[model samples]
Target: MLGTRVSAFLKLSKRDLKYDLPASIVVFLVALPLCLGIAMASGAPLFAGVLTGVIGGIVVASISGSALSVSGPAAGLTVIVLGAIQQLGAYETFLLAVVLAGVIQLVLGVLKAGMIGNYFPSSVILGMLAAIGITIILKQIPLAFGMTETHAFEVEDGGGIAAFTNTIFSSINWGATIICLLSLAVLIFWPSFKKLSKIPAPLIVVILGVALGFAFQGTSFALNPDHFVSIPVVSSFAEFKGLFIFPDFTQIVSKDVWVVAFTIAIIASLETLLSIEAVDKIDPFKRNSPTNRELIAQGIGNMSSGLLGGLPLTSVIVRSSANANSGGRTRQSAILHGIWLLVALLAIPTVINLIPLAGLAAILLHTGFKLAKPALFKQIYKKGLDQFIPFFITVAAVVFTDLLTGVGIGIVVATFYILKANMTNAYQFNIVQKEEADMAVLTLAEEVTFLNKAPIQQKLYNLPKGVKSVVIDGHKSKFIDKDVIDVIKDFEQNALSKGLSIELNDVTYKQKPLNGNFRLKKQKLQKVV
Candidate 1:
């Protein structure tokens, strides 16, 4: 009986692992450099990136709703992290913020705020993605030129042009620069080489760069070792001892910690939600992800990351998209990707150390270019100015300011545009009831939200002065927000003075008022009805 059970379990595991193993390996190849780069960007220890990858894969993957989406430390948080570290006064304090942030995320998931992600317009999503791509490209330029530590303007920092100019004026690492250019050339032209067309270009570039590093190690032709990958040197478990740094619980009482904690939670939630939405759109199977479940998975992953002295993790689109494009079809791919990080960090640190920073930069640069491609802008333009304007604004704002700030600006602008567009064709108040009739019937459209409140309020206020009954026909309305319900409550109170009776038709109040009024209470959707 024991052997039978063991055999059954093994078969199940094998069945689940088969196709995803190869894809997971591919994803691992892509995730490693990104993990290192993002960790460096976030002002965290290099191993923090590996920790995030592991937790995201082995822990988060076990609970995440997404089948293909991968989570880990993100480059998007680089500026936030740098600022947090500076403000918090110590890495340990910042880690406390991370832990608190995870707790906040867990609360959000419990409250099911994940539905908020559904409200963001597709245009804004596309624009944000494009901006991220541009930022990646701009940020990688210095590394591509083997100019780490040389401050340059980056797209994310809104210094792309300035950075490019500065790099041009500085002394160049000609050998590393040549390799970067050559790698780009091969990536662009390798498809022409019929036999090599199917090869993963980035892997090839990395291999070549590493080989060159070894070949020229002892000669005048050698590139500076500092420009190469810098995995921490460890001889034993004790040497790897300080890799995990716990958060300082002493900061738990500080207001600043709470502030940073909430900020991290809100931003991380937004990023994760957006990433999940985007990943779902790209999923070939078109399976929708459970947003709340994703939030929970992220919360757990981040909590673990924070507890272990690692940076926060989120559903990063770049890595997730890379995994999907590489043919990953299951959670095992994500889990395996994490396993690769562990193996590389522990067993192959020397080989990783040989990879040139310039090569990795080249990979990021290529990715960035793909994101900011002119074709995407043209496509947005074709969708109409409503789409193009918001997208452009989002890109510009994100590039000039910061991620959250940029998104806020975009949301405000998009809201105004939406209001303006809706106002023109909003509810038309046509009285269907005759003067002799006791009831005045008003039919609402397919949907109504706070934006329609003004028009609705105006229609209710101007009700023919003598109508005995006011019937709101919401049978056609699919959904109504609390603001509109509040307007209705106010209308109900005033209806007594106007000698009119207000009645809701085919509409059940989804929420109850806090004070026994008709005001809609905040509640979760229990069913479609």
Candidate 2:
């Protein structure tokens, strides 16, 4: 019996691990550099990136709903995390926020809040993604030039336009700068050559950058630890003792921890949802993820990450898309990527350190350009003004403010436009009666939204003074908003007082009526005549 069960489990596992091993290797190669870059961006210890990638792939992938989605340290969370670290005053304290954030995410999953992802307009999502791409390119420029001095931004200088400009001008490492330009050239034109097109340009660029760094090591050019890939020092198993930093339990009493916790939960959930949607669009297999399950997976992964002295993890679009493009067919690629990180970290720290930071920047810059290409903007514009307007607004907001703030602004603008469109053509009402028992009926038009509140209110107010029975028929209406339901509730109250009857028909959950009649069926009228 034991042998039978073991064989069954192995068969299922093998089925899940169907991606070509070569593709998995490519994904791992791509993921390693990004893991370090994102960790650096977040102002966390460099190992934090590797740790996140390992957990996201090995631990999170084991439980995730997405088959091809990859998770790791994300650039999107950099700003919030940096601020949290500064505010919390220590990495350990900040870890407390991460743990609390995990708990909050779990609660959201239990409540099925992942459904919120379905409402985001596709145009807005594309714009936000493009904006993020542009931001990554701009932010990495300084690092590419080997400028590490501008790393610290005082509390007063705020992190938008001014700080970015200062960082650009104040420190520029010429050696790294030249390498970046060369790397960009290779990435752009390498695809034109049929013989080289199949090769990974970024990996090639990294190799060249590393060679250049070695050549310039003792000459006029010198590369500091900050300008090269950082491999955490682990002399032995005992030296790995500091790998996991525990959060201070005392932070639980502080209000600030809760604030950070909620922020992480909300932002993490939003990013995860958006990434899942984007990944599905790119998947050749067209597998739909169970959103609630995804939330739970992220929650568990993040909780584990925090407890293990790592940063928060989320389903990141860039890595997930890369996995898809690299011919990853199943969850095995993600899992293998994590396993690779662990193996590399333990077996080849010295070799990993040989990779130059400029090389990684080159790869990222190429990625950024792809994301923010002019063709994308044109495509979005062609979709129509309703789509274009919200998209542009989201891009501008994200460029000017931080990620959450920018998305919030886009949500508000989109909501306003949506409400405006709904209000203009929202309502028409008709009254009818049946002669069998003098039944009065109210028929609503094809659409009724919260914006139709005024019309619904007026109709109820001017209801016939002598009507003894009334029914609201929404059979023809495709949608009914919450405001109309509130109006119905008010009508129900007044009808009872005036010896009239009331009934509702053809209401639906999708229409979101104000009353708890989400799935309630049409019922016979109660007469008061």
Candidate 3:
């Protein structure tokens, strides 16, 4: 079985090499800055993010059932990681939590809890993707303006609007800003020419920024070292080995550790499921990824990451979407990107450290714009209030609050509309006036439950005195609740006192012997006045 799986994978990789190869390069370029940034934001060692990216790509991609999704240290988990690190009192202790989280995810996958992702409304999911795009744009703005990580941190701590204003007004690197603008221009227009499309725009952006970085050196507009990607350069294998920080197993019994572990597991799993769902929607092939297998893959990746001193990882939409947009056709792109990350980190760290953060920021900025485009908003609005309200509220909530909280709120709103629709559409009522006598027609819907009993009863009890006959039709109903049937029977009894003729069409009650419960069953139409 294992050999067959390997053979199938090799065949797929070979078939899509042309598409996956360049796409992997694009994903690698995109993943680089994000991995570092999420690590910095999480208050962990910068190499931790690179480690997560490597493991997620090589380990998780090999095990996952998804074709295009990529995994890495996610920006969404930064707040939780930062807090967990502080609470645990050491970075090593937090790694223990990450491992425990992986175990929990494995259990969840085994229980088939991945199906929970299917319950999320499409509107809420779309809103979540849009909100993430907006957040990415907001976060990358300072970097695009040639600001330092310190300045970006200030924006994060100070509130997005006020802090962003102060940071941008206080300092600006003209060199980095110029390069960022040039990079954005290249990204915006590069895909327009079909012939040059195979060469990823992000690569050209990096090359342009690197060339400009050299040209502006020693000048007044020169970029500060802080504006460039910073990876610690190691001269020997021993030095590189020294960078790895193992988890502290001594903290395994700590209650705080378990709490952090559960938090990470649930949040990471949710984010991974949501990311894959979004990626599948945009896939040209419209393939359905196996969610349970994805959870298992993520669980193994997180365990390996924690064991080797890396941040927790999840399937990241930013990188995955980039892969898809770049024409990635299979999981090979994700795996290859991880290999590139490992190679770059070990072989030429200095060269990578020289790439300006502004260029990467430009790439992310373009990606963000595509996600939250005005066309998407207009399209959702056209889907009607039922879809638009939940979608809009979800976008607003996610922007103002955290992702999980926002999605939860959106789900509540969507569920409310669903219940409202079910209540209002319980049945169809119409009145007809004939020369001899007026008649009323009441048709039951596909499914009638206890919640619909009040409305159905109300309509029948309030019938006009001039109506001499009433018809209750259940031919279209597949499932009719006992409460609804009781309502109909009581109304018929009430009608007898008013000298009204009543007719029943294809409705009867069936009692279950095991549970002593009853259900409405179809029967021959009958009349009883």
lDDT of each: 0.77, 0.77, 0.90
Residues 1-529 of candidate 3 have per-residue lDDT tens digits of 9988885764455779899998999899999989988999899999999999999999999989999999999988999999999999999999999999999998889888899888899999999989988998998888898877563436556576777777766687888889989999999899899999778898899899999999999997798888899877888999999999999999899999999999999999999999989899889999999999899999999999999999999999999988998899999999999999999999989999889999999999998888899999999999999999999999999999988899999999999998888888988988898999999999989888888888898899888778889999988888777788888878878888778899888764454657777654576545785
Clashing pairs in 1: 153-159, 511-521
Q: Estimate, for each residue in 58-152, the C-alpha lDDT of model 2 and write its tens digit.
A: 88777777878888877778889999999989888888889889888888898998899888877667777788778878877766887766554
Question: Which runs of model 1 end up more than 4 angstroms from their true locations?
Answer: 1-19, 151-170, 189-199, 215-221, 427-529
User: Candidate 1 has what TM-score?
Assistant: 0.75
Clashes of 1: 2
- Give the winner by TM-score: 3
Query: Candidate 2 — which residues are off by over 4 angstroms?
Result: 1-34, 37-43, 83-90, 151-174, 191-198, 216-225, 249-256, 424-445, 450-475, 478-529
**Which consecutive 10 residues in model 1 have the weakest lDDT in total?**
520-529
Where does the lowest 10-residue lDDT sum fall in candidate 3? 149-158
Better of 2 and 3 by lDDT: 3
Residue-pair clashes per prediction, in order, are: 2, 1, 0
How many angstroms is residue 228 displaced in model 2 relative to the true structure, after the best TM-score fit? Answer: 1.3
How would you order the candidates by TM-score, starting with the best? Answer: 3, 1, 2
TM-score versus the correct structure, for each prediction: 0.75, 0.74, 0.92
Q: lDDT order of candidates, best first?
A: 3, 1, 2
